[model samples]
Target: MYHTWMRFFTPSPLHRRLGLVCLGVGLQHGTLPTVGPRTLDHHVAVVISAGSGWYRFPDGRRTTVTAPALLWLTPGVPHHYAPDPGTGWDEGFVDFTGPVTATYTELGHIEPDRPVVPLADAGGPRSVIGRIARAARRGNPLLEVETSAAVHELLVALRRARADTNADGDLVLEALARDACRPLTVAEHAARHGMTPAELRTAVRRGAGCSPKDYLLGIRLGRAKELLAATELPVAAVARRVGYDDPAYFSRLFTRRVGTAPVRFRAQQGRTVPGGWSTRIPDAEHPPTIITGHV
Candidate 1:
């Protein structure tokens, strides 16, 4: 299911702008070594595409390593890592160093404190490493510069790949689905998921093909209809139950959106048609919406 290799690099920087230069590049999968903890003079980024492992830090802090993640081996840090034999990882690594690397750390772009960064784009790191490996193999003129360019790109890719897992739109959708009746603003919903309103809107639009506010309203209306049909709750009670503080406003909105008032809609559902009472909810013109919302 997997294959790999490890390559060492010896790049001579062709220019100063090529701040970060690759020292070595390696690819490994399903391999284990019983070597002791080692300290390196150069920084190495190990991208894991599959399987799991563990990384032991110099401070004696050990962290679990999972696939689709980045394990950063910072310079002068005593660290050791190995793939789980039962589920050895598909790994691609690049050893790099330069003055710009320190700048990267200061900018919080490369988090030395966080050794394990779970990757969001599973194929991204692998692709970067694959490019570096191919460059290393060719041993072309300006290989140093070419690899250095790739090294910079690698860092950027790694950073992008380590997106906040919680900020993902699916989580927001799940939360909204769970409590659509909760009275919360769009900003509050986004904040709950560690995102800004704009970010939440973009994510929701991409994931649900609808605005966050619209989605929330959809869920609220859906829940309100359920309560009106399944329960004996009054109009005002149903309005409040579905997050509307003022029953008059709820009734007006319900009438506008549903093509009928809430009371009449409930009555229609209560009356028997031929075999069953089929009260069509509002928005039949639109496709079924995911009426759930969460931050």
Candidate 2:
């Protein structure tokens, strides 16, 4: 036999529009029998924290599972699994879904092909599950929003805890970010790291889930936005500062990507100081630093 405690929820359309909603959460132990051979309409992250098990796909391939692993049951995917009757297992799970799931999948936060994933450690994911559990309490008015917010944290924790990510890739991403404002092409950037253009693409795609150009453009556009909003810089100057040599090309690119021309965006978002932009507080007047978050 097995033991379990679970709570399911039906969030309002308004809550679902928040981009991720937790549908349920639970803790289970003992030999859990078999599950699914059925498909689900949403996603579920079944975190196996202890014991051992095996899972099967519709193709008849079966794989062994150990503790500190995760089983991703993505939408419309058929799944089947069970805990070993002798050893049993401890399991915690959170069910979630939203349009952001698509983005997460694109970003490699959710893998459709690989369902049974080994994790480096289950502590971070387990903590998020506990938060979801606490928010699932009955009569809690903030249940929907709180649980939904935790779902984002859960994804991030899972990403960080994955057993297979390359540590060296983090260095690549960091270097790219540091050099993002340079007028270097992806090929030039790749050469600086002694990698081919194709290799650079692979590294960037694995780490950031986007191409090198997209990543650099994201940084450039963000810095351009800060300059436009905080300083009275001309659009042409802002474009050149962000590495765009041609003002007309920059304006066109900005307009196409941001849905507004540079001048128009500055007009809408620019800061107008009552005094000149020279108001600076003394270092002694700065607020004290405070560390904060849930325990």
Candidate 3:
């Protein structure tokens, strides 16, 4: 015998264009019945938080599942799994699909080949699943967007939870991100780590799912955006701080990726402190709205 709760969604074509849309979510425990040797048209992430189970491979091999593990059921891929008969398991899963799924896969967030992945902890993924569940309530106006956002969070959580990479403590990624502001090439970065460029590339791919240059650019651009929005520094100073010596080049790249020039972004975001606190405070009842971004 087993216990289960689940909800399914049929999102509109427009919702799907939002990059990642959740199709379903569920919680299951106990000695669940066997699932099919079946195929699907989308993807599902079954986060097993406790107990153990087993799943079948396309070639008919069976792999054992343990607590704090993940099962990636991808589109057009056959899957069959069940919890251990007596001990059973607690599992939370989210089903999602969209154009961004391809990018996530390229970045190694969605591993179709590695169906079962061991996790360092289930707490993070479980939390994201909870968010999806709460957002799944019927007639909720923001259901689609909320759940879709949660799906993105779930992917990051899963990536961080991976037992092997352990993205949170990944020394390589951490070092790269730490030195992201340095004007260094991928090869130079590799040399500093005593790794060949190819080896460093492979490591970054396994840990962060992107090439070294791309990863560094992502970090650099992110910091440039923060400086542009919050700091009073000029564009050239901001560019230098983010490892770009040439302000014009930095502006071009920033505009290409962010779809806006640095000066324009700053204008739109405005200053949070606005030349420090004013001597006169605004009325409490009519306090102005404030906004900020992580990037």
Candidate 4:
């Protein structure tokens, strides 16, 4: 047996900092719309819980995204999609806007001109969205923070999807992920893979579903998230450890990819501050971390 629920959040003038909408649907045996391509007013994260569907973008690119896959919809992108007529579909989705939404928009990851990028593993995201829906239904005060974190998790999943698609891409991404916490360059990575930088870029795009540079940046950003969440390390140190010698540049990249400055992200995670100041410190007891950082 399957059940469905949906929640909608209207923008409140009193609460200017956050916005959210959640939708859950269970089709025992039904069909979705065959509407023409339409643009969204805000960003959307879709998780297919059961059955499968076909998505078509304005550019004519099409992909059959199945259950346990995610769809990212950027505002203003023309897209049209429908569920598999026979199997019907069960899905959950959340739409949100905040500082992080703007950041995603700026990073080009939320492509307004392209179709949704399917997450390799949609289970985590689906679970998070479910939680968000429940929280909203209960009118939880922490909904803003929870929804924001859930969206971040979804974004991280998308980045992993981009890197873990095919074997060749996995090799390049694995190499990048391994060295992301250290200083690494495109040429150096290419040499390690026995290919020129150009060839490596092409290979990465085909295999990982994104360019080599984007893949490396994703790796570094993923690491930055770990330091922000687990350690009291200063943003500067976190930047350096993640291969950015310049803290300011790292801040920009982090804000762009993560939708908040490193300091803010940590604060949102409920870390304590000292006399209104938060300094980053390494965690002695924390185990060696993975690139995903639990996102």
Candidate 5:
């Protein structure tokens, strides 16, 4: 693998909202900088397209990052990196600042210090970033939409990377996801798959990067997020649907996991849970106005 670092800057409403500095990265070759340590003004995400390298933070913490790895640098974090002595590095990075940056921060995808997350495989993130870069270069009117979609795909790929590490662990996770609404203990789940609870737990930890209980909680929380965003269900009803009988407990859990209460989340999204299940529509005295003209 080769080693390299590149940066992109862009100016657009979408980019401004996302705090993204550049778009449409291209393949390039360069020597790693030997400059003094510095902190970025915005979030920086680095995707190694090719190569391996060693990275160091101002705190003197260091980690060797390989190609197909992702490096996240939150604003005000002091960091510097260099290519490996023998094998150079090839990488692309973008700087962004925006409302959605907090979302990534909450997901732990962005690190305050230098943290390199190795991908399951290189191709997925590379393709996504490459496509976004290409679209940005084209300067199309829909660049924002395309870039946002690509960024989302990149995030999903990163999330799935953890699930891809263990053998058959991804399949087990998939099975669990299919039945997330149902309550099942580790032993019961393992018994259905001919594996012991201990073995299942180990596999889950390896694949999900969390304990079985934590994984289950994540599933419940994800379902809660959907309900909060898309439905008019009361917090209690949503909690019950996700397996929590006590709305207070569910509210606390939601706050811990989602960083907000269910009601606030819905409100922020400009939605409301209609009370009493009424299907009322305002009656209009006049028909809606429509204009039709022949060209």
Candidate 6:
């Protein structure tokens, strides 16, 4: 049996806006006792990677939790859960909160009252959780942003897992989305996907309701906004990072697309410091502890 746990020392505003800011994560196997019947302040997603357990709720409702299943513990909800020590279980859990969480709840993607969500496969979820764990261990400079991004991916993966199916367009869309972040031409992206330019364009239009060029630009612009609002990088650096080679051209395009210059956009977002226009969060060095237990 094995167990591990990690806690973040800080949180970021952008993470909060996305409605999924990770607070802590844990993984454990072997006999485990029930945690609480008390109300929790933040939502907790507990995934049973393997084995079995039981979940108990406030109204005296109880149910069995099996492997490859996700359990949602909503904020202010009283709950308790434990593994059947006789059989034991492997568990991965992440605690998170954000304003957008309500949107998900409203959309029926996550039902607060439904505690247990059985998953057909847990591999994707486990991999994402593993990534968060590793990033925590590395003490990455943008830990908050990095973990937040992982949480976003986790949510999407959870939804897809629950659907238990995929559309062909989804693959093309995913490929385009990932490749868009780099400085790759549409033809290059098409070639990488083993498709002609026209085929790629059609796939993107069918999937995203936009032409390939527009879709890529949208991605680049969205990333530019994030960098502008959340980081201290210069305009040229930000432009280059988002795949633009010439800062001058990037500025013109940004102004044309976003209707505001990059620097001015940053100012509009928020002052970086008390008196400065920069909004970059200083990446401070931190030493985090990782604990593992065996029985």
| TM-score on alpha carbons, each prediction | 0.54, 0.84, 0.84, 0.58, 0.57, 0.54
Which segments of model 6 are wrong by more than 4 Å? 12-19, 163-295
The per-model lDDT (C-alpha) reads 0.78, 0.88, 0.89, 0.66, 0.66, 0.78
TM-score of decoy 6 = 0.54
Error of 4 at 60 (Å): 6.8
For model 6, the run of ten residues with the poorest summed lDDT: 279-288
lDDT of 5 by residue, 27-80 (tens): 544456543377776766677656778888676877787777777766777777
Q: Name the better of 2 and 6 by lDDT.
A: 2
Instruction: Sort by lDDT, best first.
Output: 3, 2, 6, 1, 5, 4
Local accuracy of candidate 3 as per-residue lDDT tens digits, 47-128:
9999998999999999899988999999999999999898999999999999899999998999999999999999999999
Best by lDDT: 3
**Over 4 Å off, model 3:** 167-169, 231-234, 260-295
Tell me the lDDT of candidate 4.
Answer: 0.66
Give the per-residue Cα lDDT of candidate 2 at 197: 92
TM-score of 2: 0.84
| Winner by TM-score between candidate 5 and candidate 3 | 3
What is the Å distance of residue 79 in model 3 from its true position?
1.1
Q: What tens digits encode model 4's per-residue C-alpha lDDT throughout 38-98?
A: 8876767666666787988687888886766666666767768777877767676777665
Per-residue lDDT, model 6, residue 69, is 88
lDDT of 1 by residue, 18-80 (tens): 788888888877755633588888898988888888888778887788888888888777778
Q: List the residue pairs that clash in candidate 4.
A: 232-280, 232-281, 233-280, 233-281, 234-280
